[model samples]
Target: MKSYLAAAVQMTSKPDLEENLATASDLVELAVRRGAAFVTLPENFSFLGQETEKVKQASEIAHKSEKFLKTMAQRYQITIVGGGFPIPVGDGKVSNTALMIGKNGEELARYEKVHLFDVNLPDGNTYQESETVKAGVSLPPISISPELGKIGLSVCYDVRFPELYRQLSKQGAEVLLIPAAFTAYTGKDHWQVLLKARAIENTAYVIAPAQTGNHYARRTSHGHAMIIDPWGLILSDAGEDPGLALAEINPSRLEQVRRQMPVLNHRVFG
Candidate 1:
């Protein structure tokens, strides 16, 4: 019954970078006190403002936020999965990137958001992330630690694409990290279902941290950040507010579910 504690942090990030970072730090400390060895932050945990504002604050991949992540990991002495933040790549476009840092404050892995949100919502909201963001060319198959298990990394919109998850599982991913800032309109309808489906189908643990509440006049996120087991059971849910959801990732249980159903073994197509 090998297992380890993991946590998902939900937040209602604001336009202010320092304020948002402070909120995230508090939540991370809460998760740490709760005994989580692996903690994940929500998308845009450091800043969630207008597109122009995001670009203005964006730093190159190697600076600012990266240093913040390293320091946090070292201070906490735990693995930290940093959620998406803007990383400038020139030409007024940035990359929405996620990072995994080891307890020793070393970089473990990085995942750039491959899918950009370019939808016209029924609630009359339109987003064109492609305008200021560059899509990643590949998915990241990361393992923070041998005992922690191999991880599949993805961000908000990437959850809608199952092929990405499939590819990750194929590459030996046993845990999936989906840090998101899902809009209230669509999240209410699809968030939980999508999370469960991915876990059940992959027979893997799915940990999702999310942005909750309103960030601006035009933006609101549906919270309910959660951790789901391979059996598709909701081990923990953060509800519709800023908080932390904690759960244990049981590797033996994951193996049990996979052995019982064997869906991954029976897949006839890639």
Candidate 2:
């Protein structure tokens, strides 16, 4: 694989689909201007609002989000991993899907989020992701690009599941895209730690775009969009603000880490 710059964009996406799309486009343009060939936006980049509203507007969000990704990819001449968006699947529910598009506006990969976030937080935030999103059956898919290496796709809460990442790495994924709209409560303690663990264990570059700040109602997201190297180093971290984390994804560095520590080859179980 060839070396290139990748970007993880951080922004606050509201319930307004048009506004969020505009914001995401601007950030992608920013990354491209700064010489990033691969850029990923955070979860719910199209619309992050109340669950009821999301399901009601799932059709519109799906159409517009797909168009936005294609337009941005072709117009900017860069690959994009669109963060989780809602797609209608009947029965009054939607699937939280992550998409990867090539520079030519061709679809590269798609993964519906599997590990739904259903929990009661200590900060009084209870998430029932399964209530609205249909769980995916297949594992995360990987694309082996000549320039980008084997890139794997997964959405927000999937980061919490190491088995998913293990499967990806075993399937030859060199770079893992984990775009998220992580809640502030859990992210403060778990975000970076979890990402570092994934990178270290798999010896793969972890590119995670994230949502930051308040969206609506009692909802808030942690804003540290980050890029981690195979050596478990934090290459770039976009702080709690509307910005991006840009870093070089060098193949040599990845190889150096893997050769120095070959854990994936020694794994024993599924």
Candidate 3:
């Protein structure tokens, strides 16, 4: 089908896993009620702890864990893009991974975040994602359905890399899913602009679900969950709040944009 409802869920997750899952479940239910076939959650939707060591300690193996993801997906009966979670990677360090679960609660694809957020903002806000998380070496995009088209999966920090989006578009991604827990400082400055740029330059729909508000230990996040079309038009946006934003994905529009711009065909660089 050319028309499909997509949702971006904004959450303010806390350190408590149970509470976080509850909040996520409520939002997912709300989105499904709004007729969204595919719903995306924000990064660290299960746990947004302040300490890296705490997150590492809470990391779970995706295959074995019967926790938040498995239960949520099955209960919702909708394609749920579980936001970035701390997953054990066999090494001492855990990988910040995003899980895509189908309607039947089966794991569809797993995209580990390749680019880690390592920045020292001038506001004395310093983050070293590499401190407790390991980087992913491979760049593999996931396809939900041939009709829905291929989607390039990315986490919070990966939004900064334009090359990744270009590569994904080159690899035939019509839509890019970015689930992030961006800091308020950076999100206000770069969130919408970067998302729109990615959509405009790649000629692809950008689906970004963000974590908003403060979580545990005074950790604050910028929450502006949005869905943008291929022509750089924002279909829907959830401002700084805990809610859901719905938009219809039109393949015809995407085709029109690509046909008009043809940037995907004009690319010559690596």
The best candidate in terms of lDDT: 2
TM-score of each: 0.97, 0.99, 0.94
Residue clash pairs of candidate 2: none
Q: State, as a TM-score between 0 and 1, how close model 2 is to the true structure.
A: 0.99
The residue-by-residue lDDT of candidate 2 on 216-260, one tens digit each, is 998999999999999999999999999999999999999899999
Each model's number of backbone clashes? 0, 0, 0
Q: Rate the local accuracy (lDDT) of all candidates.
A: 0.90, 0.94, 0.83
Candidate 1: give its CA RMSD in angstroms: 1.4
| TM-score-based ranking | 2, 1, 3
Clashes of 3: 0
Full ranking by lDDT: 2, 1, 3
lDDT of 1 by residue, 1-270 (tens): 248899999999998887877787888889999999999998888888899988887873337667778888899998998889999999998999999999899888998999999999999999999999999997776674676888889999999999999999998889999999999999999999999999999999999999999999889999999999999999999999799999999988998999999999999997
| The 10-residue segment with the lowest total lDDT in model 1 | 59-68
